[model samples]
Target chain A: MKTYKCYCIDLDGTVYRGKEPINETVQFVHHLQQQGKEPFFVTNNASQTPDQVLSKLSGFGIEAKRSHIMTSAMAAAKYIAYHYPGKDVSMIGERGLHDALLENGVNIVSSSKEVFVMGIDREITYEKLAQACLDIRQGATFISTNSDRAFPNERGLMPGNGAFTALIQNSTGIEPIFIGKPQGHMLEMIRLEHQYEKEDMVMIGDNYDTDIMAGINFGIDTIHVNTGVTSTEEALLKSVRPTGTFETLVECI
Target chain B: MKTYKCYCIDLDGTVYRGKEPINETVQFVHHLQQQGKEPFFVTNNASQTPDQVLSKLSGFGIEAKRSHIMTSAMAAAKYIAYHYPGKDVSMIGERGLHDALLENGVNIVSSSKEVFVMGIDREITYEKLAQACLDIRQGATFISTNSDRAFPNERGLMPGNGAFTALIQNSTGIEPIFIGKPQGHMLEMIRLEHQYEKEDMVMIGDNYDTDIMAGINFGIDTIHVNTGVTSTEEALLKSVRPTGTFETLVECI
Candidate 1:
């Protein structure tokens, strides 16, 4: 097995599955940490701030660095700051996205015809969506954190950020530039921030579509674990297979 | 112009646009009422009640009967009452849908696996959408009022019922049974209630996709008034053309 300098790990499915940590993944992450390597926690969950994510990880007995946590919100903020600098941005998101934008020095406005970013806003309203449509129609650059259609909760799989993004897209007939997994923006952000080559990075996750495709899209090696959304059998069936497919991260350890 | 006993007029584009009524449409409605024909005002707007719509019409100097007004909410209520009688139905809508379901004697429950109906809910919440997805995933029959992607408002083309429906559909991977224009449910309801044959009915509207398509789908005559969404030139390009296309309802008068 080959080792990478930067291991980009997905949070929800890879490290833990909604409050319960996968034992093998936890062990593998521990092994990496013991080797003086800090893996980046790359999550598409734009709802939570880095500190919140760190708290969740700490609950699972995994100590992660705040700077090593690259959320979709952070990536979107950085993407906007890098691409459209000095442009006023309008957003529809939660605390994570709002904080990330402020941290990245992106000017937040009530409404803008410059740029618009969206994430998982639990308190979503018709007025927010309406304003987004109006802005997009007025030639605002539309950007979304992720394209996850539905995500699992304690109750069931609920509508995620992508569904709301779909609403705005359907209403305005405009597609948004997604800055999450399967699009490679987050992975690219990690690479650029840490000054690591593509070969030095490897994405490890249990989801085939978001995690594996994200790595592949970013031209990095990907390892798919079968302890979550996609099984080994399903991952093998894809035309462009992952670099490695295992029953669990224990195999890598 | 071919005279019809039942003239099924669309509300938004045909009768009025936003707060203002089209003068020709007002005159046309007055003409029909003077001739002792109470034309049915068929609308995909599931937000307002029949009385509310009637009051708006009356404000434009056109007296319309309460029974002669058919909203998507009413049609959805009647559809549920007829097909799935006594079924506990769950909904995501406003006063119109709420009253319509209760008036039709359809049992309304907080959450149900029997039936789920959705309308244009401006006060849409993430929890409401989550509950709807959960109910639909639990094998509930999903139904939406209309499929109009965007509706005009004071601001601009805001996210309509169809956009929200698309959100639920995307999340649950379930197609909803649309009970609005372009599906013929409202027209079918009007036909069944008034005991008028399809031949005796004519759908008059400014939007070709919703109004004309509904009439054609219901196997009734359709008149296209170029005063709203679809222009007369664009209506002429469709493979299935309306029976008549005019600049305004004054041409028909």
Candidate 2:
């Protein structure tokens, strides 16, 4: 376990099913901690807050701190704060984004007749959309929390932040500054969190399009989990496949 | 206008900006009406029902009958019905999908875990996701409304049905039968709707990934509008460029 300085695990399939964590996950995580290896819980699901995720993991007895987790939503908010701070933002987002911005002390307004911060808001409205258009036409900057359009749920799939991003972009004729997964910022943030540079990092996740692709795009090592849509065969067949494949952490560990 | 038999106009930049219709869009639509050309409003936006779309369009004084409008949401439900008829479904969608499936006379249940049709639901919940996963594990067939991931909107961009499609795909290791733009079905539907064969019809819209590519994929002439994010320059530089490019409909007309 010491051989791996940093181990990142995906939710949904790799870690647990719903509220129930994987059988081997707890033992493996305990082993890693005892071996002094740092573990990171990372996901492309931008809908949930880190606290929410941490709480979910806590249900499985894996005590994770907010600092121990990195989400696309958080990463996106960090990107915006770094590049365009102190701007009046018109937000279409969930608690994750609203909390992130408030943490950074960014000003948010209801109207996009100002700059718009795009986030995953499950309760989207047409009036909000109208305000976003108004902002874009009024020459507001467009910022996206992340570019991931969808997230897998037990019900099938749900529209992630990118869905709202796409709609506003089409109507307003403005492109957004994407800040999350499948982008470079999250990689940097993860690297900083794990105290590993790009070369030493390995991204473990279930989705190929987000996790593996993020590693590939950022020139980092990737490990794909078969627990998601990507089978062992599918991972091997990718144009830019991951460096390793695992059915679950039980096999990899 | 009589030189063309069908008038396929894109929603965002081609028709209106936000709720306000674009200049000359009203006249061109009226022009088509007067010239006795059949008008079809094609949108890759799978969020709203066709009637909702019509209602929105009507807000700006553009009269659109629900029958004259086509969306990916409609295409997705119909495609699923064709393959998995009379099966209980878990729907991850908004009113658009609900209306479409209802219109198609497909039976839907709340706890359907066998066959599912996923679309963009702004108010998506974990229960819906869990049900989808449970059904898939139980050998359920998954169908997506579209694969666009995101669509252009006045709110800067929003999660389109494609985003919803991706979630289920990521979880179940299943690929959806996409029904919207850029996919083959919508164009086939367009041909059928306009009573025009592939050779005689032309697809005009703003999106390159959807409208232009769908047209090209189906062997029809394409007219690309820079209504959405794609500028006229970007639209032409595409590997699969459109047959013609216009900044706006008025320019082409």
Candidate 3:
């Protein structure tokens, strides 16, 4: 098997399932580290900062560097700073997104009709949502971190950022520029920042739609693991198959 | 011009414009009352109770009976109680919806998989929305008070119940049965409850889509007034024209 220099990995199912780590993937990551290769952790989660992700990974017995974590929030902030330079941004999101924009030196304004970034805000209110619509109606460009409709919790499937995005889109009749998986902005960020060629990079994940499709969209090799959202059977049904399939990361290692 | 026995009038754009009364509509309502006829005030507003709506009309110098005011929340509660008798319902809404369901004798449960009613919840939270999605995923039937994506407020157009409904619907992959305008449930409720025949009724409003379309869908005569959302010129352009078009209800009077 050919070895890739940069391994972009999905976190939720590939590294850990909520609080529990996937042993096979964790072992594979340790093996990669032993070989002096630091794999990048790519996640669509916009609520947690890289530091927070690093802490979570640490709890799961995985030693990951802060620079190796690429969240959708970071990508969104980078995209805004790159595309609309010096434009003040109004946002509706939580700490992770706030931190990302602040770190990226994007001017954060309370009210602006120029650029608006949306993320999952637990303390979401009708007033906040109204302000977003008001801004969008006033011709503000809309951007969202991820498009995961519903996320799993201790109780059950909960409303994700995508559901809120749908609300705003339905209200304003404007589709937002989604900066998450299946769009490949995150992968592009990793590639450009690290200067890794497409041939030397690979995306390894458990979900076919967001993870594998994201790799395919980025024109990179992808390995689908039957550990999370999309099982091997479901992944095979898709027309755009992954570069490889594994029962777990143990086979890849 | 023909006078109808049941004059169904829209509230926001027709009778009043955001706390200010449309003089022509108020005068027309007074004229109807002088002839011992109480015009029915129909609104897609699911946030206010019948008494609340009556008070608003009274503030406009028009005395309205509580029973004469038809709100979407009332219709939704009645619909749920009639269709799924004795079934417990989980809901995401405000005082108007709560009072209506209680008045209609529908059991409101916190975690029920029987029926789910959605309305404009100004104090909306992520947890509440998540719970609603969970209940719906557990096989609960979905119902929404109205499908108004956005409504005019002091700040401008604000996200309405329909927008929130869109959020839940997107998350759950379940379409809700909307009870408000353009669906004709509110009109049907007024007709069935008051025993008004099709010819005896004439729906009057300022908006062509919700108000005029409600009357059209309800199989009744409709008067399009240029006092609010849709202009007379815009109304004429629609493929399904209203029964009559006027600058104000003064023409009908």
| Chain A only TM-scores, each candidate in turn | 0.99, 0.89, 0.99
Positional deviation of residue A42's Cα in model 3 after best superposition, in angstroms: 0.4
Tell me how far the alpha carbon of residue B231 in candidate 2 is from the true structure, in angstroms, after superposition.
17
List residue ranges in candidate 3 displaced over 4 A: none
lDDT of 2 by residue, A1-253 (tens): 3245766666766687665677677777877877787588877666688889988888888887678787767776676677777777778777877887777677778874546777777666655655675677678888787776455555445555665566666555578887765666777887765578666677777778777787778787888777756788988887877888777766666
Displacement of the residue A234 alpha carbon in candidate 2, Å: 1.3
Tell me how candidate 3 scores on lDDT: 0.92
TM-score of each candidate's B chain against the true B chain: 0.99, 0.89, 0.98
The best candidate in terms of DockQ: 3
TM-score of 2: 0.57
Per-residue lDDT tens digits for candidate 1, residues A131-150, read 99999999999999999999
lDDT of each: 0.93, 0.71, 0.92
* Model 3 TM-score, all chains together: 0.98
Minimum summed lDDT over a 10-residue window in model 2 chain B is located at B149-158
Which segments of model 2 are wrong by more than 4 Å? A112-114, A193-195, B1-253
Models 1 onward score TM values of: 0.98, 0.57, 0.98
User: Chain B of model 2: TM-score?
Assistant: 0.89
